[model samples]
Each structure stands twice: as C-alpha cells, then as structure tokens.
Target chain A: MDRNIAGVTIQVNEEGYLTNFAQWNTAIGDALAAEADLALTPRHWEVLNYLQTEFKNDSPLSIRKIGKSGVVDIKEFYQLFPTAPLKTASKIAGIPKPASCI
Target chain B: MKRILILGAGTAGTMMANHLHKELSPNQWEIDIIDEQEEHYYQPGYLFLPFDIYEPEDIIKPIRDFIPHGVNLLIEKIDRIVPREQYVQMENGDRLRYDILIIATGTKIAPEETEGMQGEEWKKSVFDFYTFNGSLDLRNKLREWQGGRLVVHVTEMPIKCPVAPLEFAFLADSYFKNKHIRDKVEITYVTPLSGAFTKPKATTALQHLLDEKHIHVETDFAIERVDNENKMIVDYGGREIPFDLLVTVPTNKGDDLIARSGLGDDLNFVPTDKGTLQSKAWQNIFVLGDATNIAASKAVSVAHFEAEILTENIKRFIAGEPLNAEFDGHANCFVETGNGKALLIDFNYTHEPVEGTFPLPGVGPLRLLKESRLNHMGKLAFRWIYWNMLLKGTHIPFVSTHMQEAGKEFA
Candidate 1:
C-alpha cells in the first residue's frame, strides 16, 4: 500500500510501515517523520544512523546495545525522540519496525 | 426498600459488597451483587502463573465465600444495562431493577482488537498471560523451552496491572538463568512507550534495571499485524520483529455490556468523575477500577481507594445530602525486579513517585522507587492481605486512602 504525503507516494504496509527498505530515501524519511510531528535533528539522525548500522549487521536493537555502542545514552535517546526511541528511530532509519518488550 | 445493584464480584465489586453491606441498613436498602463467573481471580498473581510461582489453588476461590451474609449474590451473564429505565437485562431474560447501580465489570484483554493477533498461531506460538487458561498454556510452553528470541510485547496501553509486563520480563530473566539456559535466551522488552515506564522518574529507574539485565528495549513500535506463518509481529511502519516465543498483552477494554448500554468511551470505559468516582453521565450510577476512564492506573489499590470514597458518597447521595469525599487518583504497585527483590511506588493525581520512606515519616519498613528484599517480601505477603484484609473491607491500619507527602523527597 502507498500513502501519498504532500506529493510523495511512499509505499507502506497495512499498518503503515515501509514495505521496501531499498525504496526508502531521505525525502520519504522526512515526510514520514512529519506525519508523527517530529522534526529531524542532527542528534536524531545519529540515533537513526546507529539503528541502521546495527540492523544491517543483524544485531538486535536495544537501548543498552545502542548505549554500549557509544552513540547516545538512553536518556538522550528519549530526549531526541520523546515518545518511542526505538520505533521512531527505526522508522526514521528506514529499517524493519522494532518490536519491544517493555 | 431501595435496591443497590453491583455489576461484578471482582476485587472492586467484592470490596464494595462487603463495605456497603455493613454501612446500609438491611431494612433501608437491598444490596445485591451479580457476576457470571463462580470463581474470583487474584489478577496480580497471573504474572507468576507462567513461571509456576503460584498454583491455581492459591489464586482461585469461590465467589460466594466472600459476600457478606445479608447481601444477595446473583450468578448470571449481563446482557445490557437499561440505565434510563434503572434496570439491567440479563442473558437469562430476567430484568433487575436498581435504585442505585455500580459498574465494576472491569477491563479484559481483547486479542481480536489487533490484526491477526488471534490467528492460527494463537496459543501455539503467540500467547497472552492475562487469563487463567492463557497462563496455564504459557506455563506448559515455558516448561520445555530450550529458548530463542523470547519476545514480550504489549499491543496497547491502559492495561490492568501496568507494571506486570515489566515484572514478567524481570521474572523471565531470573527464570531462564535458574534453568541454566540464560545464555540461550535473548530477551527483548517491546512497548509503545518511549522508555521503561509511563512516569519519567520510574522510567529512568526501570531502564537502568533493564540495562543491568542485558535485556533489549524496543519503543514506539505500534503493532500493525501478527504474521503468524512467518513467526513475526509487524508494526504500523512495516517493521517486522521475529520471535521464537511471543508473549503479548493484548488490548484491554471494558465489558461489551458497557458499550451496548451506551455508557462507555471509544474503548468501552465509562467516563467517571476522577474525584468523586461517580458516573459523569448518570447521577445514580458509579464506576470503579478497570471500568472507568479515570486518569489512574487500573489497579486494585485505586479501586480500593475509589471504593472507600464512593461508598461514602453513595451514603451521602442516598440521604439527599452533599457528597464531599474525594479520591486523588492514588495508585500503589510493586515492581518485581527478579532475584527476590522488588520496588514499590506510591503516587496520586498530583504527585509522581519519588525517593521516599513509607508508612512512617523519615522511617519506613518499606522503600519507594528503589529495589530491596523487603519490597519483594511485601509483594509476596500481599496475597494474604488481598484475601484477609483488602477484600473484606477491613481498613489497613496505617496506609490511608489519601496519599501522604510527609516522607517523600521530590527530585
């Protein structure tokens, strides 16, 4: 399924997750973040980059792992993306939706 | 005599039954409680069921054993409430009229609310630990688990026992370690919230503990569907999380009878006045516990507090006098952090839980927002209190309904 946001036809799943990670680009990421009322900051991008890097390596994404990677602490991770750091970070990073156990 | 009808016989309802039976003169009012189930559940104990920490005998009891001598207990499924007519329609084609009504039917897990959550993999792979049968099934599965990605997921919030899922993860960590397969299991905690908990301070404290356990946290992932064939859960943004074993807390909603009666919100929770514990829609009706859309955790402590004030107001309302008693949205809960240690938090409508000593000023047998062996002991000892004191409407000696700020230090 595709959601046309402000002239961009982005493909999303039934639940609105991106279908093809390959098709995801910076424009699509910015458009998606806007839908969630988030403005991307350099720090947000840092978390997103970290998510993308770890996900590419097939390492499980968790706050402890990310903090241990020396990117950002969990508190700052929540600060950069207030409500949901992992899911929002994954969406912004154009990776598979992160399922949590909290 | 005027009829006082109570909807459920759960924790809140049972407590109210006992409380009101003594307060209202038997000649002036007829107190009656109705529920379909014959057994009462200690819902907090469900968290331990998966790990075999509690036996069925410990939590289950005959509902009739709790009701006071004078009150009437009706065992029947409710069809709908005719509040306009001041009567209830039961599934047996009987109508129950009431001078005053109390809705304590409570919230339940709605697995069907989420897409594909109750599909082919339900009970086989995907499971919920919210019900008695669900716990039994999970226990059976956990007994033989060599272990893989043991994923614990919450579909949405406003669930009964908010800290239960976290406690489950903590207990699971201890469970696997004790089984000598701790290294074999990769545990992940998935929630839609930003951090470890709803409150900021507790979130940081819990996140610290999660980090210590080497457990992963996945945040802001709203589930879209459960792809059972693929053994994965997909989120709204199309992110897929695979699991070898999936434990989910499905969406919790009030009884369908609430929606059928047109007294509920979009999620079937009745709109209740937070302070008075009275129904905003109906003058003679009241709601408590998981059935109310009050900004409070759907906990037994909140229900107990609400019952205390509501009982007082009900008496006031009957006498054509002013109802002055109030509830401050007080919530008290224990978080089990594994290895025989737990944390206790006490907060209300205005106060967030902080570092504190409880029960006595500057002196507490129990600490708040910090883990101690004492708190875990309290959690275990609570089972005795739930049965002997709480449900019987016996007032706890020192713990008042209103939260006291004397010993707590705000950060």
Candidate 2:
C-alpha cells in the first residue's frame, strides 16, 4: 500500500500493517516521539492498540463514531489526537513510516 | 489634511463611514464613499421576508439618507484601486485620490461560479436569500406553490453567517407546517463541512438538532456542479441529491472591483494581517469585514467587533502613534431553530462553541449552544438595533469587542 499525506510517503499492506519495519529505523521513531510532545499514557496506548487491531481486521475505525461508542468523549479524543488516530498510531507503531516522521 | 476613501456603502462600509464621520472633524479630514447601488439592504431581514414577517419596503432605505452631510457620496461603479497612486478610479474615467483607504467591500452570492446553477432553474425552482431580489422572488414562488422537497444548500465554506442556512431550513419546516403542508414537504440540509458546523463541538450539537428536526444532512459534499436538467446537485464523488426547490447560498466572493484592481486573492479577498486588519500589500490601506481573507466567519457581528478594533488603530495611525495589533476572530451568531426559539453561538479563532451562557455567563439572557425563546426574541430585536444604534457607530451596551470568558461555565 502506497500512502502519501502532505508530501510524505508510506508503503504498507491492505490492513495498513507494515511488512517492512526495518524501512523505518528506531532513530526515526525516537525523533517522531520527540517531535509529537506527547506524554505516553496507558489510555493512549489502548487507543493505538485498538486502532492497530481494527486496521489488521481490514476495517478503518471512524475516530468520531468510536469516541461516541463510550471509550471517550469526542472532544477528549480530539484533545488526545489532533491528527487522525490511525495516522498518529501508525507513526508510533512504526508500521508505515510517515513521510513527515521520516 | 487626510482624504479617506471607503468602498461599498453596504453594512460594513456604511457603519465605518458613520464611524469616521463622527470621529474625524471636517477641517482635519475629508471622507468619501463609493458604491454603485443606491439602495441599502437590511440583509438579516431577508430571512423573514419569505415568511411575510418583514415587508420588502421595510428592508430597503436610500443610501444617501444614511450617509452624513459632510462625507462625499459618489454613487458610481469603482473601476480599480490604484493603491500606489493613492487613488481609486471610477467608471466615469475620473479619479478620487486618498491619503488613507478603508476597504469594507462586503461579499455577495456568485451563482455563475457553479456550473448549471444560473441556467433554466435559477429564480424559478432555485433561489438565494443573500440578495433582496432573490428573497422577493422566492416569496412569490413560496406563496402560491405547493410543498415539495425543499433543499437548503451551502455551496462552500466561509459563506456569510454559517447558521443562516440552518435557520432557513428550520424556518421552512415551520413554514410548511403552518401552511398545513408539513407532511407534503421534505426538508434537507446539504453542507460541505464534515458535520453541521465547521467547529467540532458545535457540529455535534447542531447535528443532533438536525436529527431531532428530521432534516436529512449530506456532509463532506463538495459540490461539483448543479445538474439543473436532472433537478439534482451532482457532487464530485457522483452523489446525486434531488430537490424540487433548491435554495442555495451560492459561492460568496468579494466585490468585482477587488478583482479588477488585481490586489485580491484567488477568491478576490484582500490579504491582511489577521489581527491588525492591516493590508499586507500596503501600509496605508486597511480592510474590514468579509473583504479580508481571515479565518473567521464572514458575518456582520464579526464586522462590528472588527470595526471597534480597526477604528482605534486608524485613530492611532492618524496620530502617528503605534498601531494596536489586537483583533480576536470574535464572531457571534443567533441560530433561529423554529417554534420561536434560537441558539446563540460565540466563538473565536481557537475556541469552538461550548455549552455555556453568553453575555453574562451564568446569568445569561441568552444560552450558547442551546435553543431558547429569549434567544429567538433577541434575534428578532436585532433588526431594530441594527438600523438605530449599530449603523450609527454607537457601542452596544454589554456586548464587548472581545469574547469575554467571565460568565461562561465550561462543559
């Protein structure tokens, strides 16, 4: 899968699961981690895990609808994730290297 | 002595003319306003015209009557603004020189921008409320016509008063209901935004309201063209929404004079410092209201808030004092939601519409993000305030230029 957003390139599978994690070394992930300015929390991790599982199941979750499904309020979910949860989690998971992250 | 030239004697321009006329003395400064049309329209009253709440005669007044005696009122089309030469050329091959220029040239519907929109259906099956003529034409059509699929559409974002489209939809629901044809007519709202509003929180609340009213919503629909022959609006994604009566807020663009002058953006809006209202192209030139390429909604209330800040800055510029860079994207809107109730929304650049009380926070006569009868009354009362106090440059009591955080109890 070829994914490009705001001039960044990413190659992944149909489920957006990465076949090549080696394409993005730890240095880029560490750099992205520094730039995001996010404090890693269990709740944030739970969302990332949920999104990864959803993507693996060949279904992309609607961030807003998911929020309204009782996990969190839509506003709080946005506060947690300004960009899309899938895109942000993809960066953290190092599944497909975000062009911006790289 | 300074020669100040203002373009378009519409709501924003008229208010600014009244403001400068009151602020500056005749001996110290000379003011001139240029507009092609002689009639001044009460735009807000257009919403009520279709329902016979406001007479067409009541909404119009002579432009010259409102302009003060000392100011030069040139009822002519502007050819172009030659800012480098500090003058604006008129259609009659005459030039009016200026020491300072204020651009309050507001926006209006541009139907030609959309494909097939201005064709056979225009003003017959289709109408717009932005213009006085369109409203009157729609009124005549709605009077004798039976109810059908009434589609209230917004062509794109940054249209004047975002809530007005929703208000029209709500009012249509009530109008058909009153006429005993509520069951016959189906109301639908089509917006380009992801939800009902551009803001996230307000979108959820307004989406809920839309559901409660049984109004169907088609979101994220970028209108490619109006398929007039098929009686449907075709989106780029091939989504065809049928409508019997298409009331659309056509693409709103700045005055043609801006495009002719070659000083405006792709949409013909002048680029200005978002906070200062100062023109990016020239130091002496300033812009206000819908003419600027600002992120805020192009509404009269925003213009009113911006006028306060811009007036102060202009005074400073005249005095050789440092300009004050302080204009929050303050926009306040009253959303009429049928059944004698309305919702008030107060927001700026960063803040979205939150559930709270406005004007006095906890003791608000108006509630933000919630429907109330008092808000409806306030919406009705504004037309009186607009003509009497607002246009006269008198500060409205209790309504501040900036959004006050005092009274609001955050959700």
Candidate 3:
C-alpha cells in the first residue's frame, strides 16, 4: 500500500500493515497503527476518518463533533485520543517536530 | 551582622540576589542563595522554543553565571524554612541562619496530582512545556509529528504565566501552517478557566484571538485524569476531550519544601499580603514569583514589578523605616498572535487589558489589545532585557515598576 504526500512515503506489507513509514516520513495514520502495535481494527478507523477530514480541510476538527461522526463511541473517543496522536499526526504529516518536542 | 537568605536562583531569587548585593554593604551584611538546580532558564524563552525561534542553549545558562561574585551560592536541596527561628534547613544536614528570608522557591509541575497524568503516555502522547525537559521532549514529538487531534490542556489554575497555554495554541497554529501540514493538524485549546484568559476582559480579547486562529476552546473543564491506556482526558464534570495528542500544563504547586515548612495555603503557595508580598505568617519572610498566593498571573513581568516593590520594602525593613504601601499588582505581557504580530496587555489588580498604546501614549512602538508586528518584536527582544537588565536588578528606563495609566485608553 502507498499514501500520497510529498516527502512522506508510506509503504505497507501484504496484510496492509505498515512496513516502513520512516522516522521523517511517518504519517499520523501510520503512527496510530504503530501505537496500537499492529492491533488496529476498523474501530480505530474512526481516528483515521477524523484525521482525514482534519487534513483534507487543513483545520482543527472538533472533538465532540468528530466523536459523533459515527466512527467511535463518544465515551471511547475521548478515551483513545490524547495529545500524542495530534502531535504524531503533525509528524506523520511530515512537519518538523518543534524544538520543545526534542 | 544581618544575613539575608534567598531561596531558588530562578528569576525572582536571582533578581533579589542582584538587588540586595548592590544595596547592602558587604562589611555589614552577608548574602546567601540556595538552589539545587544548576541551570538558570530564561523561562519566557520557553514559549518561543517549541516554534524553533529559540535554541535550548539560548534559553539555558549555568545558574552560577547569573549569581554575582559577592553573594554566596549554595547549590543544595532545601529541607525546610524555620520562619520563626529565622533559619533554613538544608537537605545536607546543615542549617543557615538569616535575619531576613526571601522565599522564591517557585513552582513545579505535579502531574501525579491528577490521575493518569504521569502514566506511560507522558512525554509520548501527553506532554508539558513548563519544564525544560518537557519542552525538549515536546520538540522531538513535534518534529516527527504528522498531525491529528492536538488538545492543549491546562490542568488547573495558579500555573505559571497563565497565558502560556494559549500561546502554545497560537504558536502551534503558525508552526503547522508553515510546515504545509496545517491541514493535517487539528489544534484544540482546553482550559479550566472560562474563556481564553483568567480575567474577564482579557479573556474576551483572548477568546477573540483564539476564534480568529480557529483554535477551539473548551472552557470550565476541571480535568479528572489523563487515561493513558484510552488516551483521553476526563474532567470532573464528566466532560471528556479526545485527542490524538495531549499537551498538558499539569497541576502547578509551590515547592515541596513549602509543604515541609507548613507555610503555604491549600494550593501550597505562601499566604502573602496582596499589597506587601510579605508572608502573612512571618514578618521577616517575603514571597515572590510563582510561590505567592496572589491573584496575579505567574509571569516574569509580575515578578519584575514585585521585585521593585519588595526591594524597596526590604530596604525599609532593614533601616527600620516604614514600608511603602505600593505594588499595584502591575504585570505587563506580550501575547504572540503569530504571523509577525503580537498583542501587548498591561493591567493591575483592578483594571483589565484596555485598548491603547504602551511605553509612549500617542506614538508607542507597541500597541495594546490590537495586534502589531512591533509588539511581536518586543516579545522577542525581552529575553535580552530579562538577563542583562531585569535579573541584574538594574532599572529599565521607560518601564516603571508600577503600572502606568498614561497611555491606556479606557472604554
């Protein structure tokens, strides 16, 4: 599998598992899969859906509304998402990590 | 011979050390400073660090470099301050007697105070920018970040530089936008305080800025815990904020030494006279910076103004003269709104951030309420002013110790 974004190369294996989304090119979608340690189900796809919309629109997607987007349960949505994913997403987007992050 | 002991060589203690060293005669007075940390951080620089504007080396210098020659610098952990006996106990089993004590031990991040805040996700998914290490970790995270639901949460009140959380949100907006991944990152600002700021008037103004930047503000959220396994922040009100990334300003409290001394209020800050800054429990003890329980923003500007007033009072107390009923809680801060523009706000205990020009009333280089590029430059320039002048206890020419009303336009 391959994803389209400049300077970002996402390659997955036969099972659509991320094989190499290297340090500099890792996408939030790929990071999410890594964070779960390849245990991502379609239920985790709610996060990917939210991220897709957020990236497509190039703006901050609302947490509450995103929760109601029917991807995940409202209770579980708050449970799964942390500041790390958003930060990782930025990294996955191939944006340079801030100095404070280092 | 009178001895003055200043605790913690951070901004407030460093200023007091420099101030007292200049005022008191070495022949008559012995000055000493105590702190365990070796590095003196230009804290204001931390706000600019994550954005790649300031290098870590630029923000940090050896703590000893800032302490002048005349003063004795004791690099050791403090055990407790025996205010009644006018003596401070050290962790190394030594006691230092002081005629007068300046408690500037400052505050620290206590993530454990909130459940799950310091779990496996900390510095991974959840991060804090308050500490140097935290900021550095965040830098690494942001560098490799692709973007997701980024929730910037302020755990509770009494945190240092109340505006920092909002600044992080604003800076993040600019950071991602510049990287061409602004589309991929979703930034949300979460605060326990209502609106974007602590004060009502300023909150309104700051909320407008947040709205302008498209950073969603979740107000009145008292965070219960950071569920690391689940990766969400749950509030006491059952309000849950889900984020792909969580940047938190955890519960800020005074030094653990204060708890040992049994001198602080419920929040672990010393109970100080709002006007005098003198510890209510002890006449010889004074608290400055983030260690005091004052209704002021825990920013360096407030500490700078407080230093001016406290230094004067310290002199009077030494000379057996009447302490001045001054110090109007003056705090002036520059808020970065990104894209080479910032907003300057100056207010005291009574007033809010009003619309006006600063420094020079009619022809100020810095604008208030309204954003300007000049104000952004002023914010950038302050790191120099803080080290070379402010911490040295040298008086700034145009900037008065008290909040000036000449330039501000009141509605």
Candidate 4:
C-alpha cells in the first residue's frame, strides 16, 4: 500500500508501518508521528534512532531490549508513544512491528 | 573412539541421544548425555496440574528410563563449557572433551527478573505454573479458595508455550463455573502483545474465544513491577491491574550455566545459526530448543522436529559433507480451549496457522485452528506418545518434518 506522508509517497503496510526503510525520511517520520497524535521531540528521535539501528542490524526488538538500550527507559518510551510503544515507535521509525514468536 | 557429548537430558537431549545411538556405529562413535536432575518431567502436563487433571506421578519418571542402553548417562553438574578448547568442565573438577557438543539445556522461568514478583507474596497470592512445584502449589491454592479477581499474565514475550497463559485463563473460567462461583470470579488475561496471540489468523480465532468465554483481556501491557503491598501489577505505562490470585509467566531465560559460561545474549540465550542449528561462535557445538536465540517457538514439537534434522547434520559433519539447512522451524501444538475441546495448529517460519486439515491433509482426523473434542483427545494421547515414541526419536506417522501447504486456507 502507498500513503502520502509529508507530501511524499511512501510504501506502507496495512497497519500504516513503512514497508521500505530506505525511503524513510525525517519529514515522513514527523507525519507518521503526527498521525498517531505524537509530537516528536529530540528524546523521541533518540529512541527512534535506536530502534532503527536495531532493525538495521537484524536484531529482534523487545520492550526489555529497549529498556536496556541506554537510549531511553521503558517508562519514557511508553510515555512518548503512549500506546503500544514498540508498534508506534516502529511505525514512526519506518520499521516492521516487533512480533513475538508463537 | 570419537566422542559426542550432549548437555541436558531433557526433551531435546534425550531424543538426540536416542537418535545418535541408533544412527552412529557404536564401535566407531561413543555418545554421552549429562544432566544434574534425576527425573524426566512431562513439561506439558504442568498445564493440567494446576487444574488437578493430571497427577504428579503421571508427568514424572526417572530420567534414565528414556536414555538408550548403549549411550552413557552422566548425572553430574557442569560448571562451564570451554567451547574454544572443545571440552566441558564439570563442577567436580573433571574435564571431559568431545568431538561434537549438543547443548539443549532448555529455558526456565525466572521470577526474580521482575521486582517484587518473588518478594513477600511470592507463593502466597502470586504463582506460576511453568514449573512442577509452582503448578502443584497453585493446585492446592485453587482447591480451597473462594473466587475473586484472577489475573493470568505474561511478563514478556518469547516465553515457552506462548499460549499457556491464555489456556490457564480459559481453564480458570471453566473451573470456577464448575464450582458454581463463575459470577464471583473475574478472570482477566494480561499480555505484552497487542491481541490474544502473536499471529494474525490464530489471534482472531482466539480473541473471539476470549470474548465468548467472558474473559477480560488487557493487552499491550509491558509490566515493570509487581506491587505486592497493594496486590497490583503496575506496567511501564502506569496501568495497574489488581488481582487476588496472580498467575504470571515471568521472564524466561536459558540456563544460568549459559551465563556463567559467557556464551549467552542479554537474556542468557546462546547465539546459534537458526538453519543449521550450529553455534555461531563454535563450529563443533550445536544448540536447539529453548536455549538457542532462534525466532522459532520454544516448544517440544519444535525440538522433536529439530532432532530429526540435527541428527542428519551431525552425520554430515562426521562424513566431511556440508551441513544441510533443512530445519524450517516446524511446530505442531494442540491448544486446549477448555470444556473438553482443543484446537490443533501446524505452522512454520513462513506460515501462520490457518484453517486446514492436518497430518492426513484433507482426510485429517484432526482439524486445524478450530475447536473440537477430537483435538482435545489428540492432546491427551500425546502424553503416551511423548514418553514411548517421541523420546525414542520415532517419526510420528502422517506428520511431515516440514509444514505442508496443501489443504490450507491462505487467503
């Protein structure tokens, strides 16, 4: 699926997560965050950068991992994204939602 | 003779011992399995123990009962694994070298990972069914207790038998209703995931069941601490769910031996090649089951399937042949949905469980992703197979090592 974010066409999944990380930019991230009713601050960008780094390295993301990443604590991460922090942060950061192996 | 050392005589290690003992010539190769414990536990039975459906004796047997006669069984504690030197250091100051090493020291629930989980209210108001003692204790607790708020929770993701907590909630509903206290008891399921399960199709089916059973669900809750004083679990987002009885699957981690040996990740799970089941750090060492940091579900079915592939890979390594990357993360599980019915699901790395016929495909005696009494019977019958056939590395009839796409509804 494609969505116009920040005046740019970006590929996204049904859940509104960016499918292609290569096409992600700050403007698109701002727009995605805005859609979720979040205003991205510098601290939010730090956590977003950490999530993107972990995604690029092919490391699985988890709330526990994010808590231990030294970038932000889990409480602040939750407060920043407000709901489903990992899912929302992944969307704003242009990555896939962290899935649990079932 | 060349030596093959297997760590932990649990499900995966026991099956590997049997498979290798039959496959490798005894004259050319020797196999040894080690574990500190004496009893072989039927881990799945832990689910029924809290419901008083299975007796303690039914799930436990001497570990020696499953070990093959020709294979060596060592009841000794391992201090550490010296992977670079291809040897293991025993706690008693004995060092054993191996030509090949298989680590199946499975994962265990660590209640201490969360603050206040193991505190003053540890086994009193709070409990876990992931262990034999925990389940037995909970059984006793549920026997005499009047109904109140019952919270079945998962502290984090990637826990073993991921559906067990939900199953616990469902069973509690039936249990309370049977006791004629259904109205008095409020059952709530708390999870870290966004829905009733991980996969899309299965989650939809299970969430509907939750609604039908009248079990309240609290999703996307990443717990931070258990407030024992207030009898409430507080999440990172500051959401609090109070409970009279808290049954939580705490953080699951690999054996502490992995940590002491410095061979684990942040959660003490070993890093291994998911396809080959070989340790990424050491070529001679292999890992499977809950110990490895794989994306596969940490379930017995997965270990059963991996045992078949690991046996072949071990043989290839001995013959100087390239290893076969054939393991597809296949797992077949029967989810007990209470009221004497269950749902059977078969899936792999690429496929989420969907509606289909299993084992026999279109002619299945078992249906997939739908509740049925036949599926419940299959789950009960699995106990016999686990002890008699599965541990002996026998291939289950009609069940393939890989997931089949036939008879499945994809779209």
Model 3 alpha-carbon miss at residue B269, Å? 0.5
Candidate 1 stretches greater than 4 Å from native: A1-102
The list of candidate 3 runs beyond 4 A from truth reads A1-102, B198-200, B203-206
Q: Count the backbone clashes (under 3 Å) in each candidate.
A: 13, 1, 46, 0
What interface RMSD do all candidates show, one decimal each?
14.1, 15.8, 15.5, 2.2
Which prediction has the highest lDDT against the true structure?
A: 4
User: Can you write out model 1's per-residue Cα lDDT over B336-383, one digit (the tens) per residue?
Assistant: 999899998998866778778987768998898899999999999999
Which residue pairs overlap in candidate 2's backbone?
B361-B407
lDDT of residue B192 for candidate 3: 57
Worst 10 residues of 1 chain B by lDDT: B192-201
Candidate 2 lDDT (Cα, whole model)? 0.77
Q: Can you write out model 2's per-residue Cα lDDT over B165-207, one digit (the tens) per residue?
A: 8889989888888899989989988976554554446665666
If you assessed candidate 4 against the hidden native complex, which CAPRI class would it receive?
acceptable
Per-residue lDDT of B203 in model 1: 63
What TM-score would chain B of candidate 4 score versus the native chain B? Answer: 0.99
Model 2: per-residue Cα lDDT at residue B33:
91
Write the candidate numbers in order of decreasing lDDT. 4, 1, 2, 3
**Cα RMSD over interface residues, candidate 1:** 14.1
